[model samples]
Target: MNDINLEKLRVNRGAHAAPKKRRSSNTRTWIIAGATLAIIVYALLPKPTAIQATQVVSAWPSQQYQVLNATGYVVAQRKAAVAPKGTGRVEWIGVSEGDVVKEGVVLARLESRDVAASYQAASANRQVAEAAVTSAENEMQDADRNLDRTTLLFNKRLLSVLNLQDAKSRKARVAASLKSSQASLAAARANEQLAKTNLDSTQMVAPFDGTVLSRSANVGDIVTPLASAADAKGAVLLIADLNSLEVDADVSESSLAQIKMGQPCEIVLDAYPDRRYRAEVRIIAPTVNRASATVTAKVRFLDRDPDVLPDMSARVAFLSQAVNADQQKPVMAVSPTAIVEGEGGSHVFQIGADGRAHAVAVQVGAVLGGVRAVSGNLKVGDALVLAPGSKMSDGDRIKLADAP
Candidate 1:
């Protein structure tokens, strides 16, 4: 009875163990199948496409009409190095760099004590000469009266011929003395005028309405008209007429034919790249530069800004027509390659912050240089995919080729 019971228990345990093993094997098979399925799905999914990108920028409408382009510098057509006419040590500087001055405004003064003293002496001598002329006139008048009386007495036989001749001789001598005194007075007046001129020269004055660019001489520096001396300063101040500011652009000789007087232009300064100035061609240099094969075109600004300074690096765009007030404003622009044309009109793929491309419908306007004007949900600094492929769609992932 014990043997039969033990054998039955063993059989039951083996059957239970076999079913458990089968269950475990089934779970392992399901896990492997799920992992393989996941791998296949991942392989079928579209991957991110690598693309080049460019930034949308503000562009001028005048760029559409640009016929030629050149590079140059801002220059003041009326510029001068102000120096004293008379050589002397600098005494006082009334102005420094960036001081705006009107015409004939005194910019600096030289040591003028000697010139002032000379002028005073000349004035005193003029006074003395006038007094001498008065004395000579009085003596001449007296001599004339005496001669008249002597002539009357001689005619009445009350005076001898010798006395009459002597009276006439005295009148002649006084007249000669008066003439000498008048000549001396004229000389003294001329000397006084010259001395006054010299005194005036001691003050360096502005030749025109301008802003002072630099102060080349100090209070103690010696200034001279000709900068021949090693220690002497030729110019006390460097000044420029801001109103006369213009751009001197160098255009290739082959492109000179397209430039004309009064041709409208857009000036972009390197110092202020965001700003644009309206300008027109003022002069086309008659001669060509032999070395550079270029001609200088002088362009005058129509809209003046105080910040426009001399020698600022600039780029000029010579336009076929003038830009009006509305056209001067900047418009959103993108590279031509960035635009994609389809049956639904023009659109651009703007990369979103989520690293995905979003299609933005745009209304294309005039072409601005190498870019095209577009108005849409775009801004000046939005990144746009350049030369998007036909397969590119909205919500596609993008990898920037320019990224490190």
Candidate 2:
């Protein structure tokens, strides 16, 4: 009674519980499978490609272009402070500021009354000296004739020795007086010329072909050699020879060997925007500045500009290759801002197909003016990134900005 009754009771109670546990296990197994499948699908999704970059391009072949990028001042090769040669009062100024002038052309005038008076006085003195010399010569001639007669009489024993001696002394005195008067005349003549020259200084003239930069005096304005508060003095006018216009550019001391006299160059004047003038390296200064270690260079213009004036800002471009099969400055041209310095040294970022920047180490040469001369692995037509940090990488792809 005990085994049969207990077993039947337990089986009837647990039969429902066994099926519920099996169903619960099946639900857990399905949830675990679904979660794993979701993770696998997420990991297998595709990644986004690198973004493309924009770069600026230059028309020049990189190797053929040699640019000497430097800032400079445009200066007239022959600039001068038109000063008075002598002290004088200004009567008139023939030329004004910005007026063009030729050599020896009168530019101003000074009051020459005193100088003229002195000239006349010297001329009068010279005439007096000449008349005195003439009178002495006549007296000497008379005395000489009298002395000759006395000497002949003495020789014939008809004249006394004392009388002949007196006549000879008179002749000698007159001869000496004539010589003295002649010297006085010559001195007077010299004085007259000096006075004339001083009078001539009243007129100012152009020293060379130049443009008047300033007129310190006007008509009726008095100017003197010795500066005075009352007189407009010192530089009466600032004149500059336009024919010898040049750019005084500062160059890095390290780039001296690459520069030479007569090297072809291009110049851009700040006064004349966007116009490039043909230029040549007239001289590389032998001296260097101790502070900046920069050498000042004198560059010459092949074509003179009448409008070019002193102290105008300028830029010189040293060409790397012949601009037109003509010898020119060594300008290795690249995008104006293509040069960027990074860990790999001064380099150009040549964006590659993999959308990364390939930093090409470049040896930069002298920047003659606006053109930057660069050498090393960069080729003429290779695409380079102008903006370094903008979407640039070692192997990044680059797209050109629109034709503008």
Q: Find the 10 residues in a row with the least total lDDT in model 2.
A: 54-63
Task: Evaluate model 2: give its TM-score.
Answer: 0.64
| lDDT score at residue 27, model 1, on the 0-100 scale | 100
> What shift in Å separates residue 24 of candidate 1 from its native position after superposition?
9.0
User: How far out, in Å, is residue 164 in model 1?
Assistant: 2.8
CA RMSD per model (angstroms): 5.1, 15.2
Segments of candidate 1 deviating more than 4 angstroms:
1-31, 47-52, 353-355, 389-391, 397-404
Off by over 4 Å in 2: 1-63, 226-231, 325-404
Per-candidate clash tally: 0, 38
Quote the RMSD, in angstroms, for model 1.
5.1
Best by lDDT: 1
Cα distance off (Å), candidate 2, residue 378: 25
lDDT of 2 by residue, 1-404 (tens): 44566655565757689899999999999999999999998878543223323343222332245656677998877888887787666777778777889899888877888888988988898889889988988998899899989999999999888998899899888888989988998898898888888777777788888888887766666566667656466668999877888999998888877778888777778877545677789988888998998999898888766777778999887765434422332335565467776665777777666644687888765443344667777665666676566445465544454412
